[model samples]
Target: MKNMEPRIFFKSSRNVAADTGLSKVSLRAGVGAFSLMEMMITVAIIGTLAALCMPAWTKIKDNSMRARDVSNLRGQAMAVLAYAGEHDGVLPGRINRGVAIPSTVTTDSKRTYYLSTVLIDAGYCSKDDKIWKTVCGYGADQFGVAYVVNSGKSSVPTYFFGNRSSTAGATTYDPKRIVSLKSNLDPDKDPKGKDEEPLSQIWMITNADGENYNSSTTGGLSNSLSEDVRTPWGGRHYVYFDAHVEFKRSGEYPSVN
Candidate 1:
């Protein structure tokens, strides 16, 4: 029997050189290329993500504006307090029945502020009339007087408080007797009535008409109260008796404690 043996074959240099054209390095490097469909799909996905995020971004911007309005209201409140302090504790009177009195501070953009008072004297009302009625559609009358400040001919009014109105036959509020101050930057416009409440009467109790920033009324100081109506910016700036100024949203009056 012939002996069987395994033999290995190795190529010579000339043989290797002849096979070099068949090497796959170029093809391997080119494997990473993306097809047109793949590229298009990736772009579409990114665009969709951007669209989904836009609405939320807009909402955040709106909230920021609302917060700024509140801040301006607070500032006006502080300004009024400072004015009162320097004037012997006597609050400033309105220009007319419903008009705000201009401040001595020239820095206030020539806007006028309102002042009113509530008297706590006796013989005003009978014991039964002692119970106060709610004013301006805001629940029960907790505060006696509401001093209103008109920042400008914008929307909404800045309001301040004393306590509640006295009963009939009693001394009403006196703008000359302001002591301490509390303020609210209400977004609502002055309330309305056929015989619209006088600025003096409104100051006496919570008798402001509804915050009618959008109401259509004519004549008298009522026009001054309505000046803030239909604000193009959709809100108004107000300075409260406490020396705080705030921007209030239309139809949403702020209340201070």
Candidate 2:
């Protein structure tokens, strides 16, 4: 018989038995698995990254709230201007709701009504309007803080309304300054309207500081517990007579001419 070549058998990579020690062991040790130390290091790195991003995220959220406040103030200002246009160039200050303007200086004329109430009663805006609300607060309360005015006296609305004009020399609220309409000064209505200050110089509305109940802590508005009023951000929004809105830093206020 002719000499036969010895036959050798070789297994393909896929044909290797999984039960064999050589086949079961990974070529690169721990390539697909994480050690305890590796896992802890990964968690620490993720926490560090999140901590670094927190302040930036907080700033972004604050800016968004401020912008919303500015927009709401602008809308409220427009409503006030519209109300003035129909009422002989008179703004809503010391005006009673659902009642005629007092002709002579009397108790009724001196009585102050809430700006929101006056606006709502005149069909200018609704009570549920977001423009009447703000996102600023101290402690847990948010809505009640924005309207604080004149240090929050009893039975008085939280907004301050300076006298825009007087009718027949009637007593006016914050009677020191006379307000003008756009560029026109109604001499008959405002006897002190000689110097027509720029509309931008006069701030019609703004967030004020006062004491109010903390609804979150006090449980509701009925509680007598009060807290200082403040905005969520560090600045307050001002609405000028020209219906323009601007923001001022905390402790800074508008200078009215």
Candidate 3:
């Protein structure tokens, strides 16, 4: 038997070269590979698209938080009105931690009475309520509520009830001296009980930062912001005495009489 030439079944160099060329063509036409520049361009496009979407996403997130804040405030407003209805239309916020009945309870005898304290103690709202917090206001942990209850400086029918006590057990809270939402600040000057202003015009609550509420001025009703005023999109939410809510930008406070 003629020494069987080692039966070589392998393809020739020419055939191999042709097969390799066909494979390359198939790859280029079927699953093409990206060059370095093409890959970089794709990545860059993706990054630019993401950058373009960021602002809209941020705006959506902010608006959602704002809506939640508005809802929370509206609920609190209802709670306040309910408390007032029960208390003969008298607003809450007398004692920080006790029945608001006329008492000689002084500051030394109890925690500093906050305007929100009465609402919490009277079951109008819980201390843990989200309404007590704000997106652009100080945390509830800092104060009883994120919104300023009122200036609370004057009792001459200025607005909101004032803390008559200096410290714990330092003074008496006379029940008869209590004022309600309908109390006329200028009854002598204006015989009309309307006080020459509508309830809608009277702002009852707002983001402490928007109002630049200071603890020194508000007697700790809110924590002071000495730095830049932080608001949601340079705007803040307001809750009126009529339980109406509104969003106004900085320097856009309603022209209230």
Candidate 4:
């Protein structure tokens, strides 16, 4: 009688075997599933890699910007030379010449190039002080010389070079004679004494006699280029007096001679 009850299990046993096979397959499919700690470790590694790369990326961006500034300055220098040639080998006077190259003259351009009134009438310079006292000045010291004297107020001075100041007839200005062509990150230096001696030493442009360079808060024609020289859109762009366009940098510049 007990054997008769057990005899009905044939098809049911087959169904049980099929279910077991499916369960095994499901378990195999999940074999590579990650644990919580493993996932966290992977995320941490990715974050570390990103942090390591950040500083290098920033340096690359800065170098690229510096290169662009150099290119822009060089182009502007060429334009000035072309203008001088067209005007009977005579360089421009302060106001007229500055207008000829609107890019250099304007405060809007965000980059600067030193200008000189040496080629203009010498009478424009102040006899008491060797500074050029017209709308433009010789070096950074004489820049805004007329503005300071005429206004009788010591406002901060601005020029094709950069910002400067004069105090009690003592010119307080940048010290780096030729801005380092390599970087514009130099520290600021105030003019030293009452004789305008500190201001006279700086150059307005690049020249064979080393008189072409100018002192600027952002460095002049020297290797030390400045970050301010970069255009908002990136890269340096300049227009010269001859209406020529130039791109320049540390490696390439015009010779004064």
Candidate 3, backbone clash total = 10
Give one clash count per candidate, in the order shown: 38, 0, 10, 26
What is the full ranking by lDDT, best candidate first? 3, 2, 1, 4
> Residue 74's C-alpha lDDT in candidate 4?
42
**What TM-score does candidate 3 reach?**
0.65
What is candidate 3's CA lDDT for residue 82? 81
lDDT minimum window of 10 residues, candidate 3: 96-105
List model 3 lDDT by residue over 134-186, tens digit each: 64443332433355543232322544544455567764443222233443233
Cα lDDT of candidate 4 equals 0.32
Per-residue alpha-carbon lDDT of model 4 for 1-257, expressed as tens digits? 44554555455644655867656556656677889999999999999998999999988876675444444344334543544555554433322112112222335322122232322222222123222222122232222211111000121122222233323674433311121211111112322222222312222222111122123321342322223222232222333333343443433432210
Give per-residue CA lDDT, model 1, range 1-257, as digits (tens). Answer: 99878674887655554677533555455577888999999999999998999889877766665455445334333434555566686544432222221222234422222231111111222222122221122321222212233322221222222212224673333344343222222334334222322232222211223243112321222223333323334544444333344555666544321
Question: Where is model 4 more than 4 Å wrong at Cα?
Answer: 1-34, 93-257
- lDDT per model vs. reference: 0.36, 0.52, 0.56, 0.32
Q: Which stretches of candidate 2 lie above 4 Å from their native place?
A: 1-32, 95-112, 139-145, 148-194, 211-228, 255-257
On TM-score, the stronger of 3 and 4 is 3
Model 1, runs deviating above 4 Å: 1-36, 96-211, 214-257
RMSD of 3: 7.8
